[model samples]
Target chain A: MAEIKLNNLTKRWGDFIGVDDQSLHIKDREFLVLLGPSGCGKTTTMRMIAGLEEPTAGEIWIGDRMVNDDLPKDRDVAMVFQNYGLYPHMTIFDNIAYPLKVRGTDKSEIRPRVEKAAEQVELTEFLHRKPKALSGGQRQRVALARAIVRTPKVFLMDEPLSNLDAKLRVTMRAELKHLSRALQITTVYVTHDQIEAMTLADRVAVMKNGIIQQLGTPDDIYNNPANLFVAGFIGSPAMNLINGSVTDGMFVTTGGTRLVPVKSPDREKAILGVRADDMHVHEAGQGDIDVTIYAFENTGESTLLTVQWGKQRVIARGDRHLRKDQDDVVGISLNQDHLYLFDPETEDRIEM
Target chain B: MRDNTLKYLLVLPAVLVVFVTAIWPLIEAARLSFTVGRLNRPGSLDQYLGWENYLWAFFEEPAFWNSVWVTAIYTLLTVGLTTVFALGLALLLAPGGRLRSSAQALLILPFAMSPALIGVSFRFMFNPEFGLFDAFFGIVFPPLADVSWLADPQLALAVVVMADVWGWIPFLTLVLIGGLASVPRDTVEAAQVDGASGWRVFKDVTLPQLAPVLAVVVILKSIFSLKTFDQVFMLTNGGPGTATQTLSHYIYFNGMKYGQIGYSASVAWLMVIPMIFLTYAYAKFVFRKADQ
Candidate 1:
């Protein structure tokens, strides 16, 4: 296993930059995830490290060697593509054994190692079949088996679980975590799915527009977002940002009402950021602010109330048993410790 | 009417057209092979020859055997050269940028030219006195300056094979480009990342997937090479004392020029045997691919 470092790495296609100049240091045997929306350059960054793509500028050092000029085979990295990239013509056993065979491993030692890898992915019985003959999830396992069959310096996975059905994705996500931990290889996984990043990554690098917006542990990013973008992007039913201002240590809404006590100085334009779960709902007037419910959704685990606050809507996660309808008045109180303030102009967090 | 019956009814006209155009001619050829069929003799068409013509072509005629040998060599050279060159050209053009795509577009032009025209063009280009290729070759190797290209038997046959290969390469290259396009990019990338070198990636991953398309190309080219007539007829015309005469040219000579229609028909039917096997192989590849 090796540590991977990118020093001012950048990838540009003509005038359009795929990955703007960014640097990252991935620890040895750590599962670091690159998380972002589509077209946000997370996959591009992973591809650069895998040597599938060439960086326009900067050095990629795996262990101690700069691998910018090396071909992918010479880099000794194993990658699982988004499409799985299983050899459709080869048997599952052959697919798993390809990496070892190509690397000139002894012929006699191949079968046992292939069988063991297949068994790890629970694919022993399907070894004789081609990828086309297997189900989608089974094909995914073959891809994973192929990558792990050889103990390469690093493992690269690009949205490997995105193709499976939801249930299979969850199951495979747990399997991937277990396999990554068991193997203890340096892995850089890229995915747009936030939950995958939170659960699987030792440190998640949240990216946007070819830049890493936040790089930290899941709890650190979730609880204390570095910017308005991070706060708005991380949580489900995303963090509510109300257009308002801080006036005399009180956060006031744009519609001219004092909403909550704050520790910040007065500012004309700021956004109040709070998570959906942090908003406590009560009968009208029992909480900090009373508002009419714009919409209510029951997601089985919990109920979500989209409450009208001035001209903006804020979603609050209520207890699963709490029932409310449209236009129903409910009082909502923000957990003061969890509340965030951001400057509207720069979109940066304002410490309060 | 039931749906199946109506479907059969819809195909009736095509079946009739095929019967009249293809099957009837085959049956008539079979019948003609059984007779004496001499154009000069008034009653020769009706005279029963039985297996005499078949036996004569098989044993008695050295010229017929020479034509068979010539056809075999011609087919091998044309099919092998065309396929190899076309595969190379397809690989060169498959990456597809503005220049490569434009080159690919130009590839269709050679195919659009008739094979007979290609033969004439090659004959002109190889003219010993003032031809483009003749002068170029003479300049490149001065020993060729005085030699006549179409006069030597071996050189004449080579010219015919070159004409055929040239005419066929463009079409085969286009088919192979389509084949290369269908190979999965990610699988090739996977092989690369799996620690395969460039050549290994092609041999282990790309070529195996490309086998079906290559098989189809080989079979189709073999059939066409076996039946080669147009370019040979136009370029060499079985020249240099019958050294370049393929089986089709031999059949044409006996049937139309010598007026031995019966013997020619038997040889023509013999050539169809290999074609049947090739078509069967091609069909198997196509159907198996469809199943996948």
Candidate 2:
């Protein structure tokens, strides 16, 4: 019942388009994530849904009604801003209860509901203290508590955990996932972090240049990216796109080395996309192509080898225990099944 | 020299300047307040009269008490009216764009005029015959059509208060605009999305955050209002049987016109008491913001 439908949504400020014409349907109780780099219109899309930013042209439907002209308050959506936005003058409890108080909820009902929301966010003890007294994480919790204090139709979160430290972000991400699940509200989360999208979202819409580049599950995007942008953006160490052309159905590197056999028709120019994890590292002369290591890094979880392959450098993930030094010769083989072929001119997938 | 001694030495000239420019005048005034300091009488400044001037103003003279009453009411009305109107104007202009910004720039023109000039301009504008505000108010209110603004005792006080409020609103509006700008935009948006109506959002979110600035504004306005002299001196000059006479006008009339310097000095010292308290309060707000 809380599903959101956006039709022909476009936000433009004069010549600069924030969000181009797009349509999306977020299923009820679904945790959909809008993932993109900064200024990619993910936050704009969420704000449009929140009725904060006016759409230059579109129809927005929350629940059964078309809310194109409705104010943010009438939209029945709660948002967690990046800055937390807690009322500094009020105590934490009052901040949480503000929505209820402003709506003229009974004085008798406000306390228990506020207390419950605070308890859910583990902020029960800090209720008496003002927001200025709390740390960054605690203030973020206060913002969360305030959002959940009311049963809104939609929850729009614009990088709620981006302010937290790395360790705290991880913890909060887990807690957020758990909270969203328990609350069972339709949630739209926006973030640049791939892991957060992968772990939390029912579906992720990867966006670029005010357009949704791809919309799919984490596994689908990781395995089958629709374009060069998606292939490059979704993975850490980014998918290595080597400039080459197809000849006799074989993808050749710019240096004229035949890299892999692709299913695409012969093209004058193409780019091969491969994740670092998919490129297997072997000892010199054992693999298909031998390259000198430009850099070797052990991240404890895995070892990364940046290898000099012809004119381009490709990062290969080696086994954690693998020991290597810079300038060491290593063999890097592309996983044939995992390879992505993109048309260099169009930057679209070649559908091999 | 040692560092401590050198620091004191460096500050010595500034302290001396303050003592000469500020402290000396105050001490001289206080000494004069205790004596029969007459402008015409030779060696009358050092003739000690003790608490006679102070007691006479407090107990005997009804003119002094009338001026005190007028000053109090004037201060209250001007401070309250100026602050409320300034806040409204600030809210209107704070969401700035080309037109509103230009309008805000134009608002400074009224405040830039000297207070005495403002008083003269307002007096001219409120004249019963062929006056701009007089005709405007007459057309709007209807009941005030035949009423002469300056000739009536209450209306003269009202005109003076109006002129003061009009002259001061622009500067205060600019300050409040700065205060409104400093309020984090996130909180206001959050309130909007929290299902609060526009009025509710202002009351609960914007107002509480704006409280400190409002406090500073009120305190500042009160101090300035209590010290008001230039406008009243030009506009009303304590006329209509001393109905519009403020403390400063009263002191001027007593000391300069009547040549009773000691009595005027005593009354001026009395006026300094409230200013000291207001100054302390203003200093507290300034220092608190610094601490934060």
Candidate 3:
């Protein structure tokens, strides 16, 4: 079993830190996602683990070996790049057979193993064709089959699905999930898309500015976000962070409305993070407060109402059948249990 | 005018320029090749000889066959040696930094100097008594110190090949550097992470992808090497007993020195045949890449 450990790993290009003193222990057979915005060091961390980028300080241990100075080939790792990076001149079968061939696998053994990997990725039928003749999705499958042909110690994927179209992305995401389950290898996946992280990762390490901001499971990170960035980053529509201040154990909007009470004491400035789904949509004056809708959108599955709350606009999700128009006044009420409070200065969650 | 007509009209100037500078001269040369064209006899320009000049150059001339052999071996040696050295230099200078960038900038200096000038300079450096290379080879190898580089038959040919290769490597190396740059970095990295050593990555991934560009380089270098004339003229003047007399030098000797214009034109037309095939091959690569 292979487990990856990065102990105080730091990568700096002059003054700009790529991965700043980061330490992470990924368990054996666990699929850990390094998730962040662009330039947030997620990809850099994965590259260092893959031995593609050298760390300026500290050690990287894969299994029992301190492989800080090992070359990428010597580390026994496989990576899927964003662009698929298939050998354009090679047939699909040859592409899948490259790792085995390079490792000096038996000539007779290469054919059947390549066929098996191709069958797993559903590329067996197209084995004779070169990569140039394949579609984008087929090329991506060739990359997948190549990585899985030889069972390397760890699998590293850098935004492997980012190049596909939206519908193809969904289909490939399911395929990737199935493949990772069957392979059961230690995988380090890097992506900026929170949905992929939430769906595929056993645990996601959310990063910002070269530092790991939070490390937890999907449910833990989604429901109990560690900071304002995580709360704003992990959701589909993104959690609504309303600007306000906490006064006398009560949250007050910037427009001077004394809203729901929070457990934290008074603070000069605070941000209240509330997801759109947490707020219920009721008819005018029937809920906690009546507000006019600034914009109304019907997403087919659910309707969204951007309501004018005092002076600021906060969105509320309604049922698919709930039809409302612009300037339509609707009543809104907060789910008191699901609300979160954060310190504006530190951007950290105010644990209460 | 309609769009189709306007498109052709816009390109008409370039077409006329090509016709005037290239096509017209080719047609005139073909016409001249069929006659007994001589400078002293004014009426001989139109006196029809009908394949006599071609037959003489093909069957009656021993010096013509000698030049052909010299040119064939010359093209082979220069193209092969230049491409190998250029590919090495391109790889060394491809991963550029400030020092390497200045080094790359320095490579352009030799290429900027005229070929005729390079041949003249090389002649001076290989002089037996007090030449730079003569002294250096004397100290380094001892045997070559007393040997006159331009005095022997085989050695003169070797010196000519060296001069041509040295003059051409900078341009080919720059083109190869561009080709190496266009090879996708992702594929190389993918090979590395797929358990390939650096040498294997180059052989398996980088070289295959660079094949088309390499083919283009070889074809371009072959065409240039076949047409080499100025260096041979200035360096040995086809000397050490005509050891370095290429096809162009042979034609110039027959046409300008002996005043046998029709014979030289027939031989020049014979030279044009190989060029046509090479130009066709070069066009195929250019169009194939465009299609992609």
lDDT of every predicted structure (CA atoms): 0.92, 0.93, 0.92
Q: Write the per-residue lDDT of candidate 1 for residues B1-292, one digit (tens) a residue.
A: 9999999999999999999998999888888888999888889888898999899999999999999999999989998999999999998899899999999999999899988899899889999877898898889999988778888999999889888888889999999999999899899999999999999998999889898999999999999999888888888899889999999999999999999988898899988889889999999988997887
Residue clash pairs of candidate 3:
none
Estimated TM-score per prediction? Answer: 0.95, 0.97, 0.98
Residue runs of model 2 more than 4 Å from their true location after superposition: B1-14
- Which residue ranges in model 1 land beyond 4 Å of their true spot? B40-48
Model 3 ranges with Cα > 4 A deviation? none
Task: Estimate candidate 2's alpha-carbon lDDT, on a 0 to 1 scale.
Answer: 0.93
Model 1: how far residue B252 lies from native, Å:
1.9
Q: Is the docking of candidate 1 incorrect, acceptable, medium or high quality?
A: medium
Instruction: List clashing residue pairs in candidate 1.
Output: none
Q: What are the candidates' C-alpha RMSDs?
A: 2.0, 1.5, 1.4
- In the range B147-190, model 3's lDDT, one tens digit per residue, is 99999989989989999999889989998899899899888898
Write candidate 2's Cα lDDT for A1-352 as tens digits: 3999999999998899999999998999999999999999999999999988999998999999999899998888999999998888899989999989888899999999999999999999999999999999999999999999989999999999999999999999999999998999999999999989989999999999899999998888888999988898887889998999999989998999998889988898989988899899999998889999999999999999999988899899999999999999988888998888888788899887
**Model 3 native-contact share:** 0.75
